[model samples]
Target: MTTVGLLYPGHAAEDDFPRIEVMIDSDIRLPLFHTVTDGDSRGVEALRAAGEPERLAAGVEELRMAGAEALIWATTGGSFVRGWDGAHDQVAALARTAGLPASSTSFAFAHAVRELGATRVAVAATYTEDVAPLFAEFLEAADLEVITTESAGIATADEAAACDAERVKELVVAADHPDAQVVLIPDNALRTAAYIPELEERLGKPVLTANQVAVWEGLRLADRRVWAPTLGTLFATREPPPGIDEHRGIEVRE
Candidate 1:
């Protein structure tokens, strides 16, 4: 079985590990590390520390020991809050430290959108409205256009995890614009694996959710593109990518 390592935030993203495994019939192994964090006001320290190079290197080592062929820093805010350059450097440090292929959910979202041939996107985010703009800016920096954004104003990881798919769908469809080519839900805390199909069908466009794209990114790193379809058009549609260089990171594909 192909093994994918994930540095998931403590108190967040617990269900995603199983969601990916169950959603795909690839028989892959997901080894998770509950990353060290202290949730404080605005989660400033927690997010910053999660991307710290020294700390991330250690996380990569732990996953390496578990035989993970690829790694993902699976939190959205922890990566994007740093902006594009910082997010790129964070994954570079992980790849360098572990001497393995690496990617982050932030880049995964951007890469997924680019793979779908979309320029304009609508975002439904679980971050506080104040912080949601950072994600929009991150996407813009990655060269995607932001058409609309809706934030649920959720501040805590636990609350974000507690969000059901139906509520999330409501937020997503509400945020979608007539001209948007895709709808993105940008909170790793959410359990979005099972909702992508219905959401996409309803929106008449692609829906890229945090947990779904995060798993897809890791699987792509492991070179397991056609793992059998479950939800979303991605599983049914994406062809094997030209390999991502372990040193160069994921390509901003055409």
Candidate 2:
């Protein structure tokens, strides 16, 4: 069975793992490892203040020793704190440390949106208003337009993880835009896979969640092009395959 390693912070949102399992084929095994980051409450500040690449790389090595064939840094805000270049370097360093394929939730969202050919997007975040723009900047760098956004102002990774599915659904529903071809929820801890079909049905647009896209991106890095109807439009759409060779400095999938 193929194994994917998820490098997340301690007390991260729990919804991500289940979503990954549901999205990937049963043949894939997802083994997760948690790296503790400072702070216990406040989403924006905590993510902004999370650990650096060196610390993250050390944690990734543990997963590698455990036989994780590919690695994904599962925190969107933490990876993007250093901006695109820094984020790129962090992923590269982790790949080097683990000697395996690597990617992150931030890159996953960008790539997934691009793959879907989505130009205008609406963002629904569980972060504080202060950190929402960071997510916007990351998306804009990938060339997607942020047409609208809704922030729940929830503090802390634990709180984001503990958010109820109904509240998440309400946030998505409230944040939906008529001009948005895609609605993006970029929190990895939110259990979004189970609601993709429902969200798509209601909005008549593709809904891409952080965990779903991150898992897909990690699999793609491993040269595993997988598709499933329940995974929503990101998986349903086709784009030129990702150039693994180009990502050599970033990660390697054997």
Candidate 3:
């Protein structure tokens, strides 16, 4: 069976792995590795622990030992809290160490938007108010326009995952801008993995959530991307833009 690696934070958000496995069907395996994280909160200590190069390498190496074919740094804030350049460096380091294609949730979000050809986006961030703006900068750096953003002011990963889907969808709608062509929920802790279709139906536009995109990016790197009607727009094939080469998928350049 095909296997992909997930380098997750050391928090209590337990829905990710099982949800991803179900989303991918029984055809693939997800080797989960937890990188150090001091708390479920998104603070300096949490960021340092989650994104530290040496610790991250340890997790990647562990996944490599598990025979993973590709790697995903599945923590959104962990990757984006460092600036755009730092995020790029973080994923590059992982791919070099793992000797396989790799991506972080931050880059996965960007690539999913580009692949969907949606330039104007609304962000429903599940971070604290102070922490949410950083993702706006990250998206801008990725060349996508953030029409608007809203934060749920959630303090921890566990909190975000346990947040009800209706509430999350409410935040997504509140975050929506008149120009928004797509809505993005940028938190791997979030449990919107199964609600993609319903969310899109309510908003009348594509909704891309963190875990959903991470799975897509994982399959993408493994050259296993195929149509999955349940994954909403990110799984649907679209024409690549002028410069991107989709078959190779998400190169961070080691």
Candidate 4:
């Protein structure tokens, strides 16, 4: 069994990990550890606090004991709000602390975009108007063109988690662009795991979401490529995506 540790922020939508684990029908395990956040707010300060070393260290210890071969920080806002360099540093430090390969959701999105060989992407974010641009910027830093970004102005993870499935679908539809190669929903708090197939069918394009990418990132770090079509295009094939060796943020220690 391949085990991946998830250092999640707050309590919203974390169930997506286990849902994915079951859907994959493989020995892939996603064990989550909820990290402390400052009120689970979407503000920059709160996001930064969520990825703090102290909070992540605690989660890392728990997951290591769980036999996690790799670790991921499963929050888009918590990592991207710090900008590109900060996010890289965050994962780098996480790797050092855990003595294992580590990555975050922000980097996961960038890597997922490359894995799909997509150049342009549209973002459907649950962050506030002020916080949404940071994700676009983060994508741009990875050299992927951001076609457009639409924000839902959700103030906190609690608010995002409470949104119904139809509302989530509406947000994704509004964010799609004819020019975009993929549609990205970049909030771990929002529940998009169950709607990936439906949304991708409606859009006729790949749809990448926060929790989905986080799980994929953990597998990538573990050098585990799995075929899970229900999870969407990212996991539909076991073949290596283009640039698989390019821009992997840390050295995965065995």
Candidate 5:
């Protein structure tokens, strides 16, 4: 089994990983280790601290012991709030701390976007206004065009998690843009794996969510390509090789 360690923050939506495992039924194992965020705040300062080495370090040994071949810092808000360079630094530190190749949901989205050959996307974020725009900046840094962004202004991960399936559908539908090639939901806290297929169908486009892309990123790091038909378009496709330019945040090809 290929094991990808997930250094996730807080309690919300970690279950999505297991659901993905069951849906894919592949040998890829996603063992999530929750790191603590600063209290309940989803603000920039709190998110920056949440991805810091000290918080992430606590879970490394456990995941390493679980035979994780790679690690992912699985929160879009945490990494994006730190901006592109800072997000790269965050994953670099995680790679060192865990003694494995590392990445985050922010970079995961960037790589996932390029892997699908998409250049423009719309964001459906569950973060507060003050926090959500940074995600757009993060994507822009990766050379992607942000067609539109819809922020839910949800206060905390818990509140975001409380959004029922209908509300999740509404948020995604509201975020869709005619010019967008794909719709991205950058909140890992929301339960999104189950709704990927439906969301894609409703929007008539690719739907990329935090948890979905995180798993896909982990699989990429482990060098395993999985075909999960029910997991939506991202899963239905293959990772572009040699993969994203880790240094430049763009797609790399021979």
Candidate 6:
């Protein structure tokens, strides 16, 4: 029974666990921690301070005390605001505070994109358009090309969380680029896992969502890899590196 701790702002998306369950066949516990923001929100402040470092550290400690083998920060915008170096530092600090492996949704996406050997990617975001560049910068730092981006200009966590899945699919389809080999829907606030297989089949490419990559990265931190057709390329083809355990708590693979 591998305990993967998901640190999010509030209650998680109801549909998140089914995808994770499809990967790891064991008793999985999701201990939701309270943060100052709503579950489906997005903003620089929401990402960076919903759970401040002190609070985040405390949350990590709580999960460690509860016997979580690995920790995953389940918000993409949250960890990404700190930029690449800041994101790396946050994961390192959390790992040190919790005494276990740590990873985040942003890092997870980067790893998943690279693991699939995808060099060009199209991104569809349900955030203010301002966030696209930040996301692009983060992905660029990881050496993945951001071929195109589309944002819904949504404001507030509640609205972002309440986004209609059908609309999300439409946005993804609209943002698809001919040159892009992969499409990334980088927001946990939107329900993406449930539609990945169908979307991939239609696009003839990989489609990765925030929650899917976050869970995948958490499992990888535990030295696990899963091949679920529903997860698209990240799960279908990612290979874990040797001795990854030594760096799981700090550095992320690129």
Best by TM-score: 4
Q: Given candidate 1, what's the lDDT at residue 193?
A: 81
Q: With candidate 6 superimposed using the best TM-score fit, by how many Å does residue 221's alpha carbon deviate from the native?
A: 0.4
The candidate scoring highest on lDDT is 4
Clashes of each: 0, 4, 0, 0, 0, 3
lDDT of 1: 0.79
Q: After superposition, how far is residue 96 of candidate 3 from its true place, in Å?
A: 1.9
Candidate 3 lDDT at 159 equals 79
Q: Tens digits of per-residue lDDT for model 5 on 48-71? A: 888888899999889989999878
Candidate 2: tens digits of C-alpha lDDT, residues 52-168: 766686687668776777788887878766678778888877887788878888888877776775678999988888877788888787677998889988766677777777888
* Model 3 collision count: 0
Deviation of model 1 at 56, angstroms? 2.2
lDDT of 4 by residue, 88-169 (tens): 8898889988889899999999988888888899999888989999999999998999999999999988999999889999
Better of 4 and 6 by lDDT: 4
* Candidate 3: Cα lDDT at 168: 88
Q: Please list all clashing residue pairs in model 5, or write none if there are none.
A: none
Error of 1 at 23 (Å): 1.7
Q: Which window of ten consecutive residues has the lowest lDDT sum in model 3?
A: 245-254
Give the Cα-based TM-score of candidate 2 against the true structure: 0.88
TM-score of each: 0.90, 0.88, 0.91, 0.96, 0.94, 0.88
Alpha-carbon error at 4 in model 2, in Å? 1.5
For residue 216, model 4's alpha carbon misses the true position, in angstroms, by: 0.7
List where candidate 3 sits over 4 angstroms from the true fold.
238-254
Q: Report, for every candidate in turn, its global Cα lDDT versus the true structure.
A: 0.79, 0.76, 0.81, 0.88, 0.87, 0.75
Model 5 segments beyond 4 Å from truth? 239-254
lDDT (Cα, tens digit) per residue for candidate 6, span 62-177: 67777777888888888888899998888887777777788888988888776776679999887788876798889999888999989888866567667776787788898899
